[model samples]
Target chain A: IPVLALGIGSPTWAVEAAHERGSLIVSLVGAPAHAESAIRAGADLLVAQGTDAGGHTGPIGTFSLVPQVVDVAAGRPVLAAGGVATGRHLAAALALGAEGVWMGTAFLASVDARPSGSVLDKLLAAGPGDTVVSRSDSGKTLRMLRSAWSDEWEAPEAPTPLSMPYQDILIGDLLGQILRHEVAPLVHEAAGQGVAHLTAQEPVAEIMGRLVREADQVLADLGTTRSASPASIRPAT
Target chain B: IPVLALGIGSPTWAVEAAHERGSLIVSLVGAPAHAESAIRAGADLLVAQGTDAGGHTGPIGTFSLVPQVVDVAAGRPVLAAGGVATGRHLAAALALGAEGVWMGTAFLASVDARPSGSVLDKLLAAGPGDTVVSRSDSGKTLRMLRSAWSDEWEAPEAPTPLSMPYQDILIGDLLGQILRHEVAPLVHEAAGQGVAHLTAQEPVAEIMGRLVREADQVLADLGTTRSASPASIRPAT
Candidate 1:
């Protein structure tokens, strides 16, 4: 599967070239405008990413972004991303009109992924609110495990983080030293709000199995109430 | 329904008083911690409000907040709030373990709502991104239609908005004058990201009918794909 990072200005020529080779291009989008641009660039699949997503993300929440992207996708398939860690989340994404999910943080602590000890520990210890979106590490807004380093960067006296590659260059050495030396206070990893559900390190197969089992159970339970209609919707005044 | 604004200082005695009256107590919470507090305060039903909600809201998004609240609520019913305007949203809310939805933004433009002409116009003209959460209005973070007033408050030289009733007192006269004069650039209304769907003023009955019809269709469409097991869940690389 050919994929493109449309957020950082992937050339349309690259998308066209990939299309010419009969590759199905997948593009990640944080908003509907991005989805439109991806479609214009010949992307076959669109991932509607939300602020809850780890790494680089957008302002819109997944619940709000998915339906909007689906609307803009026209006939193209749209996948939901950000905060997608459970079977219930997958079911919710489907209900929001996505064909599937694009998960990232769920696998960060998986056995096969082999994340470093410090990173894995942080990922496991984080609650839903333990992550914050900051431009300190990357020039672009990124959701990651909060740490003392992030707090320092967020202080009033801290210099504004530069944009894009420039910011990466400015912090490259300090980040390397922190990681190489395993500075616990400064060490952090990119993760999503879904990290709240990740309490244990399991294999990919176990994770996949649990997601399917839980989602099936949820879907079946909701199916029994499928006849719920407008009359049944109680207004919460 | 004995609803409580637990965000503010709703005394425990009031909750006890309402409970004594044999009324079901409902409280809104934005995060799991808030839900725990509400539960402790004797709330019987919980509305898991997300940042996408209109007016005062919490930092968490509905997609991430609902299931967590459900887990905390245990057997207690949870209603999803924020960005809940469409039928698909209702279906998605149910899938996220919410028994129903608590809608606010969707009704702002309804004929029965009778919002001021200017406020209704702004709501109609706004897009999903047009609403922002700011502390400038009520001294609490509120989601409202973005306007010049909000822009002014967000200026670097602007003073921090005072908390709660103090903020209300400081801006009360100015807000009244703006509304009384129908100041086009200053007049705004609380709304959610779902304002993108409120294109025109319709009756509550019409809105309800459409919600039921669309939700039924979506639920039915998803029911066919309910058998989609883990194997069918394709990885979007």
Candidate 2:
């Protein structure tokens, strides 16, 4: 079985446990403060997450966090994640020294993903700035589209969300009800800032392929050649 | 002197003023929503800005915003800005369809810039996540490094800042005091998220030349086979 590194809590014990079981460990947690601990605990790789990521995220952005983690890892491979949905983004991540890229928002927009039609529609209509990072949704700072539910939590009068498991348990039923009923206006959707970039729904394979192709094109453009073709290369008149 | 087509408030007004003055009008404000308005107002070019940018910015990131702006500009030159301080970033901006790139944060780090040494030092020390968008400094959401002042404003008891000139007037003295005494701890300094990537301060001309060279190399690698190498492109890869 593939080992999934959960980043929500301390992975030190988990890393030790995974090592004991001889399983590969992946950590999805945020916060650069944890990098030393994660490395000391024997995390093979690191996933640098941004606030624009769909799930739990540390406040630091990919632009700031990736290089720092790269410096800290001392030559270990780091995967860039959070709000990465396009080929251009993938190219940018590689340029930032990421060995590979992980994208949740891109997969969320895939047809096979569990999101409903309306949710997908809303995601497609959104832009990078349309999402907000708030803890009210899942007891951690998760990126979700700006909605009434998110706005309520942002309001001064709203109660602070409970800690994990308890908070998820408390609102799980309500969240399910909202998702099942197609009540987008009432439900708060956890998504990334990349949601706004999604103009349409495509299959996961197509999306991934497009991303790879685009990234290759970008990389090729940046490689040893100066211009793509004669038509693209204009001379000084 | 080059006549700057300064966008005052409305794109329509900006265009009319530029036409009347026989100057090249530039849109200074942000927001992708303004693209159509600028086009309707006869904009000759577009500047795609990202949220990571210093000063004023739109909600769209440079990656997502530039392509759309380029498409809408319909062959007009598009200049990219916001959080661009390195050769890699400039290359990425050009790859995304921008004809040229504009940089501000880099200039802020220059010796000619008027920022106090302490402010510059603080900026040099900050990481990308150190900066945040807060309306407390300016009525509009501007990006700045998180400092005691910004943290205080974020506190529950902080007062809502007055609009524009009023706030400027009210806080002008405080700002001056902070700067005069090098009380940087009391004020949030304006900068971009790219500051985290900068390791040293160098001459602007050298930095600019390096960026152009790097961009040329990147463009070459992108499958472009043009030979218009700038003086900065050193043969050794």
Candidate 3:
């Protein structure tokens, strides 16, 4: 419960500081170098994040990044993040040598998500192609459902988005206002391409239970029995 | 033996032609729409190609794309492509509801790859970050090991590369000359982000064997047994 999961983009100081305190630290990585660095920096677990992730994601895909990170981890636990939504994804992550999965987009439309109603509505109606990765929102590569405003920012002649805090600061107030007003076309909420498939929002427990149920069904369908401890995930199913 | 798996970015003619001959058409798709379209166009199987794949790829990641494609396919076999380098990756794909996997970058290091010495050397020494995806090579988004030529073309202010056939035609002669002359900085060989995990080059049989062997181990480790026909993959083991 005291564990901390930090995005790889976050400063290394946070990872190191968490490790020094004897609390388990999970570092999300995009490339193999980061995975190795996280392990060396004393991360308890590494999450290989693909570009499909909603928040600040890297150029590499989860399918590609996870195995690379796992190999470099040298047996350290590595979880696959980004594009993680269903139980089958958990099975895939484990097959790819991930200890688990880390996801954010699945919860974006949840009952508790603070995004405005219009933003949630747009997310539910969008397809995979509806999402785009751009720095216009946060100065870093963040994936979100495409809006008229987001599309303009990616136009060939559009101004290059400012980097980091500058861009975030510049757009922060405007973005907040857009969300507050429930302007869907002008709203940009962090989401992955998987946002295309997830249409409904339900209780967190239901989502978690469904993921476990689907994963168990997938495992059974594949004729693969559970090899790891079921105590952790069984109760949910 | 009657199955043909064509990379999807190519026009539909090849796929249509193959399907007409009563062969199983497995067209690679990078997006969910492509998956649905392929199935409608008579493709027997769909390979969801992610951006991490070598050669031409799309924006979505395999973890995100595969499940989406699977959902659309309903019951059609959906294979995962791009970033598929090892058995664990294969297992992950299957877990994600892929019937199988499609791979090519893993073989780039093989003796049969036929790239120039400089390209091979670069590939061997490269990491995930060492490569890039750009249309500079053939005017389409192809992932390859980054070289001086590719980097310059990708610069923010660089002129956009031409589209398809024309771009390919323009670069064809230049690429041939660069490779023939053993130019190091000008080299650009199609590779995936998983290129970092595969370093050595051997025979096709060795690579294939390792892939199957590793896959079986992963399956077994997961407390699962092979549910599908193992004859073909088992032989490699």
Candidate 4:
């Protein structure tokens, strides 16, 4: 059975469920307190997230939070997530003592990722400063390409974004219209600042290979050796 | 003699006057047509700015405009300005055929730099996704941290920023108040996302050295032997 990790859930209940199913417990969207509780409840691994990470992110940055989580995990392996897009970034994460890296935005630009052409184009054209973290669009402080919608919400005269579920419901139909090209002007592409580094659309394997090679070279030059073998570096678990 | 490159001046007479004083004609903010005219008027170097840069920037991005400006400069050296902060960024600029990188935001965080403490703190806490390009703050598409001021202006209910000198005048007192710590809460801290990389206060020389070292390592690993010599890789002229 596939062991899925869900964040922001009750650690005790999650651990009980995992034990009942004979599955592993992994936590997401967890705080330091939650991580401690998850460990107490028998989590197999801990994933520490930083704000630079796209999608759902916690308050801490990967650089600051990852090391803390690793220390907290004791002997258990810790996974580093959030903004592990570039090879250099991954190299930095490894330098921070993460057992492995978990990437989400890096996969978003892959040819198989299935985003729209315009969206992909916008991603390619974006720079590091072209993204914003706001609850305005998705109710979560998601990293997305800066857009007219975000711009409106970020403006002073505009009303603050609605809370979760309500905000999602309010923008849901507008998002549909945007995706259909009915609201072309309102369809703002969403991605992390790493979009600047994504110059082309290629397969996930190719991108992964490139990232590994680059990261390996960086690590070797930095004189840092990884515990895992070269082949094992890829899909680092 | 200090040379102030003026590219945005509309009056052709001013350009001639500056040229008469042996002032190297540098365009401030203008279109390609004005750039071509400045070149025709015996301007020494063309400083091509992209919209990604802080302070005064044109509409185009550095990645797109720098190469074009290099072409325009012909044999003359071209300096790239705007959004360049790190050694990796400098390497990218050189790879784009720029002779040197003209930086602004990179220096804004230095110990000698004059930004307010709270402003600096806000910048340090920000992530790469925390900035926005808005004319609402300064009537130009300058990159700044997303704050209540810009948000208000960007809101559909808010009025547009005043034009140019008028905007500058209107915001001058507010900016002064922010600088003095009297109204810091009311003003949005204007800084590029590069501010996130800075963790502590350091001298400019120290920061520059770190950037140079990191950039050198990156370039060396990339197998670009041309940048191996520190002397050859001098700061932008």
CAPRI class assigned to model 3: acceptable
lDDT of 4 by residue, B74-160 (tens): 766567665566665555455444566676667766788866777777666765456677776567666777777677778867777
**Each model's C-alpha lDDT?**
0.84, 0.67, 0.79, 0.62
Which parts of model 1 are misplaced by more than 4 Å? A2-10, A227-237, B1-10, B227-237
**In order of the candidates, what TM-score does chain B achieve?**
0.92, 0.86, 0.87, 0.81
Candidate rank order under DockQ? 1, 3, 2, 4
Candidate 4: RMSD to truth: 12.1
Regions of candidate 2 where Cα sits further than 4 Å from its true position: A29-36, A63-65, A163-166, A223-237, B1-10, B28-30, B198-201, B209-237
Error of 4 at A207 (Å): 0.8
lDDT of 4 by residue, A1-237 (tens): 446476655457757766677666666643455667777777776787665566655444454456556657786767777656656566555544456677777777788897787677777777655667788776867767777777888886787778776888998887877878835446665464455567788899998999888766755544322122322111001
TM-score for all predictions? Answer: 0.94, 0.84, 0.89, 0.51
Compute the lDDT for candidate 4: 0.62
Candidate 4 TM-score over all chains jointly: 0.51
Best by lDDT: 1
lDDT per residue as tens, model 2, A150-231: 8888897899898876788888888888889978686657777667668877888898889888877766656633544422
Mind giving the per-residue lDDT tens digits that candidate 3 earns over B114-198?
7568888888898888778889877878888888988899787788899887887987898898888988788778898878866
Q: Higher lDDT: candidate 1 or 3?
A: 1
Order by TM-score, highest first: 1, 3, 2, 4
Model 1 lDDT per residue over B149-193, tens place: 889999878898999889999999999999999999999888888
Best by TM-score: 1
Best by DockQ: 1
